[model samples]
Target chain A: MATVEYRNITKRFESFEVMRDLSLSIADGEFAVLLGASGCGKTTLLRMTAGLETVTAGDLLIDGLRVNEVPPRDRDIAMVFQNYALYPTMTVAENIAFSLEIRRVPKAERRRRAEEAAALVGLGEHLARYPRELSGGQRQRVAMARAMVREAKVFLFDEPLSNLDAKLRAQMRFEIRQLHDRLGTTTIYVTHDQIEAMTMADKIVLMRGGTIEQVGTPDELYDRPVSRFAADFIGSPAMNFVEGTVEANGNAPAFVAEGIHLALPVSLTVAPGSPVVCGIRPPDLVLNADGSIEGRLVLAEKTGPDVQLHLSVAGQDFIATASRDAAVEAGGLVRLSVAPDKLHLFDPQSGRRL
Target chain B: MTVHSASRRRLRIVAAWSVVALFVFPLYYWITTAFKNARDIFDQPPSVWAFDPTLKNFEEVFGISLGFLRQQEVLPGGGNFYMAPRLWDSIVVAFGSTVLSVTLATLAAYALSRFPFRGRHAFVAWVLSTRMMPPVAVAIPLFFIYKDVGLLDTYAGVILIHAVMNLPLAVLLMKSFFDDVPKEIDESAIIDGASRWLIFRRVVLPMAKGGIAATAVLCFIFSWTEFVFVLTLTQTGLKTVPVVSSSFVTSTGTAWGNMAALGVAAMVPAFVFILLVQKQLVRGLTLGSLKQ
Candidate 1:
């Protein structure tokens, strides 16, 4: 395992810049995730670290050694691509043993190591099978096994789990986490899926427009996102934002929209009647017996476990998660009370948290 | 009893059978004619089966004296003949040309398929344009150049011309095959510690076996039957089987029996060649190109 440092790495494709001034350090054996939407330079950053892509200008150091000019293989990094990139012509055994074979490992040792790697990924029975014969999950496991046999200093994953189904993805996610824990290899996983980042990463690096937006633990990002993008992107049924003015009545501040007013925490220091965006998680807004903010239910989606209601008030729509017992139908009036501490306030024009 | 469904099924069956019959009938005719003597060949009503079959044609051609000794007919009466040395020369030239052309073209094709460089589109267009020209158009100029360069009446001249003529087609076909190999595989190999050459040999070439076989079959067939270039470029020393077969067509008594024997002999190598790579040919033709 090794620590990787990307210092002011910038990548340009002709005139368009894919990544710019990106700098971050992944500590030894840390499960770090680079998270962003598609075309947001997460994959580009990962490839740059793998030395598969040239850095237009910057320094990439692995284990405190400058490897800016070192090729991927010499840098001792193994990458599991999104499609798995298993050699379709090779069987499971050969696919896993390819890196070792290139490194000139003896036949007996290669076979022994390949079988062990296959068993680690629960693929011991599939040594003779070709990649085409394996299912999607099995193919992904073979890709992981291929990387494992290399025993490289750094492991890079470029959205490896995005191709599997929901259940299989979750299952594989656990297997990958367990494997990482067992192997203790420094891993850099890139994914656009927030859930994968949240569930898999020890430290999550949120990126937007080729720059690091925020870097923190999953809880830290969820609890206190530095920007509106982070707050909205980090959660499912994302935090609803209402554009309104913040009104301070003595010590308590209230956020006023067209037809609703939500009280804010005393920690928010916005001037009276200053334009602000109020952020609230769907689950945090409780459907109470008596409450202040009122709206008519626009739509409700029942997920069997819980029902999510889309409440429309004052030209803004708010999402509220409630139990299945609360049968709020469309066009029905609903009242929700917001806990003041759970509320997030942002500057309206800049989207920066206040 | 839907009229549309019934008619569509009927149309499809008719179209499919028509294609099969169109291809099968010519080969059936060639095989039957290969067995016939001079009179049986031009029978007003062509017979599908030979009334009397004989192995006289094969024996006569194989036993023809090169006039080194007193002329002795290998059969009761002379039917066909071939000088052993010249027949071997034709085989050598055809196989040599195919091997050289296909190997060089494979390298060129791989480069065109992978690299993004300046003037790439122009280079591809230029290669394709070479194939558009009629072989006969360059025949006169090539003959003169070969004579001036002391390449006249030699196997080297014939092989070089064949390689040049077939290079465009081979490059186009092999390039399409190489394009089907994913660029991601190359990148993955690079990250796994493989150099560019290593990636080509270990990853790209193995995947392109089907296409390589298909290209080899096509190049062999083209060089095997190429008459115009062999006729014009080389006079005495480098004549191929096609030119030799055409020599049997004299103005006086036509040597139909000898021609049929020679035709059969020429067809054997091509038949064996196709049989060896028939799987690739069927797949290549049906698929239009390799799957990516």
Candidate 2:
């Protein structure tokens, strides 16, 4: 319901600078996910948004109001921490109703609002239970309920589902998206899991070394990553990269490395003799009889619908996702081809996309 | 091999029980001495078990039976044996100082746990160091201060010194307890719109009730048994049990029966206090110093 904007924010811990003059804006009602690996300053950004951490320089604005000095309570934001910081001594209803109780809400109204929030998170039957009596997923929902009960202008989640198991994490991701859809609260969720960002974010902000690498839609990040790091970080089974130098082969450019030769798109404008790293997603490489790249099969791991094919081409390890029904065998010869558009070429020196 | 291990286990049990009995033997002898006559107390080689029990010690020490008091051949100033006032003094000083010290320590500890003042660690070390000096080393200096302020021999004077003496250990215990309650909980409460004071009183304090009880019981015991301060500072105005128990060693030969009676009676309140907090005590002793 409120816009959150960080303008030229810089965070330094003593002498070590963690974030450097980073600026980003989150639109009202947009689910903005800050995605990065550990030690990447993602959680620090979320904590600053919640007012738990002070900004070392520059301004933080919520709904266009400068709030760098505002206390957490006055900021009017609710946060769901990575550890689901529920009050261990309080019942589920009490934890959900705590913010209202702090504001001196009447008992009857607090109960009504608490029950309503609990029901929305499917925790109505757990109203009287303490946090210790709940499972990890249930505790997570209680935390979510606690945040939503306040109806705050901005919702901040710091890796909220990282503790849950895989199945539960997926389900909670769906439920969180549903809740965002229903409440339309401006949410800034920090997570290192690319899948969470891909499935849940309206805007994905990929970060590295405390700076924004790219800010785009999930499809844009996965399909059109701006750098080699983005291309490698966002996809499952990971994108495979082969080091080579591009050479002119008539109109097209051929990438040549030790015992490896592959073609680049005709439109690739990188100087034909320049060194570059060519990348391709696992799903983009398809099995074709007349494929240009050939390698000996290593391992075919079937994951229900698709098989993750691990192959050794020349001296490098490569992975491709093959259809489960495709005729494939371990240690057999495999040939795979990629569409020219699916190939991503990055500058070898700067790692920038070519 | 199994038989050898079983016999070894039996020997371990016997050794453990022997140590326990060694500790409990003195207490058993003292309790039985409270019920013995003057003659039985001085019996040849001392009576371990067989003794004709009598209530004369309790009756005389507590002034329980007026008819019995009338039967005794007494000196004109016979108030020396009446120790009910000294028992009352011990209870008042112990309870008073425990309440005072625990209140101050809890407030100081919460601030220590949450605030980031410069040299905060050094400040805590300084607080604890106050208790490191020998009690006798401070007793005489304290006596002069109490006398100069006209507080000597008063309940307020003794209560103040005892509370000051116990504050160091009390603060250390309470501060550690506060540290054990995760700071994340406080941050969460703050985000929930509760002020620091509200979060402390409503959230942190209730969670640390077990630790506070443990600290209060320790303070109560220290105040109850403190000797040199009461002995050095007070005279006719007041006397607690530990110092007053020495009065039974007058030149007219020790009144072993009456002294044993007073010792047994004075231990009840402290024993009852320990029993009341026993559950919390166990948990508090292992409090978050170790990972769960």
Best by DockQ: 2
Per-residue alpha-carbon lDDT of model 2 for A26-131, expressed as tens digits? 9999999999999889999988988988999989999999999999999999999887877776889998999999999999999999999999999999999978
Question: By TM-score, how accurate is candidate 1?
Answer: 0.91
lDDT of 1 by residue, A160-250 (tens): 9888899999999999999999999999999999999999999999999999999999998999999999998999989988888988888
Model 1 CA deviation exceeding 4 Å by range = B1-18, B48-90, B253-257, B279-292
How high is the CA lDDT of each candidate model? 0.84, 0.89
**What are the root-mean-square deviations of the candidates from the true structure over C-alphas?**
3.9, 3.1
As a whole number from 0 to 100, the lDDT of residue B214 in candidate 1 is 90
